[model samples]
Target: MHEQREFIPLDKEQTPMDTPKRTIWIQALKVAFPHTIPILAGFTFLGIAYGIFMHSLGFHAMYPFIISMVVFAGSMEFITANLLLGAFNPVYAFFLTIMVNARHLFYGISLLDTYKGIGKKKWYMIFGLCDESFAINQSIDVPKNVDKGLVMFFVTILNQIYWVVGATIGGVFGYLITFNTEGLEFVMTALFVVIFIEQWMKEDRHVSSLVGIAASVVCLLLFGKDTFIIPAMIAILGILTLARKPLEKGRVSVQ
Candidate 1:
């Protein structure tokens, strides 16, 4: 018995992982309902714009409906109508999609620790990942054992539903009712502004948005609209990186 006595290294201690113990499906439904209102209304407008565009190209309303469900991406679904109109090369479309949404790869990294638990839910959670959902999720630090994956999944699904419904409405009603759909697309940008304002109200740092706007303005002038977005993103990232020391050293005021 004395000979058998031994000590395991602290690093080598084997802790049993906890299996997730919540009804994610139910949790998803409840958490999604409140946020779903703004999402659904906003998406309805955007989806209508996309559907109108598609239907005007001689396709039926059903086209946008089908694509919205499967693609489940707002920006991607909007541009995808062109794929059906012109040369529908599967290979190019596949590659184009990867190139267009390549930013998603980086988005996933931010979620690594947040979604690490929930053995089975992790997979579905990843699939539901999108820009709006990421924005909402990343804003909060979940407490221990919270099923964020479930929340994220529901947010994503709700956002998609909005898009699909909007698109279907636009595609079907587009021809019958001809009106100015112009400038309505700006509503998406407005949604971002609203979120930014909300976040700013809760926090003290408006510096990030300031830096982003300044850099974007300069980049827009130098690079032109088509090439500005990527450069603006790079500039914003660089500014944040360069400002880290000032932020940490108390040279900057967050409040």
Candidate 2:
């Protein structure tokens, strides 16, 4: 009986309440992507090498793909490929994995404050906290408006995606490829060196850096390459813990 008004659908009339959440993700991805490009290159190369290694061992493509996603521990996964071919000893495997990944304990401790209050993201962040992710996330400076948690989340996921994709490609097509991969394995090591140099240049104080170098050299000489990592990690943690107060004081004074 009254004048007909143009009808608009309720679903299309207004934006969803979660628009801010979507915006946060988009913004975080934008910030996170550039930082991870180097890792993308490194991870892809190493992951393909790993997949090819597994394929050479006569493992199925699914093995490397699944291991890359589930294990996500770069060095340990390589060791695991060898372990799978040998005698089955859960105790040996367990201890060896712990020894290989013992550095993560230090990584976790250093990140406690940075990762605090990140809510559920903390879970996946921890899960995907590889060496490269740790370096980037620990040093990155996020924009004030964007969420740091989301930035870290994207970095972790993006790095993993690179690794997974590379591994899948190598696994699926490794047999068809015949080019030499002789020196490709060193790509990740080169990446680590680059990251270390970048961090060294960024900081004014070299105390921590010097301590790490000295400890590593000492441990490597004493324990040799195959067994040095755990000892070096232990030495670094002990020295850093004891010197925390002095380090903080020095940092404050410098500022």
Query: Which one is best on lDDT?
Result: 2
TM-score of each: 0.72, 0.85
RMSD of each: 7.9, 10.2
lDDT of each: 0.69, 0.84
The regions of model 2 sitting more than 4 angstroms off are 1-19, 178-187, 253-255
Q: Judge candidate 2 at residue 93 and give its lDDT.
A: 97
| Candidate 2 structure quality by residue, lDDT tens digits, 7-91 | 3221232324555656767888999999998888778877887888889999999999999999999989989999999999999
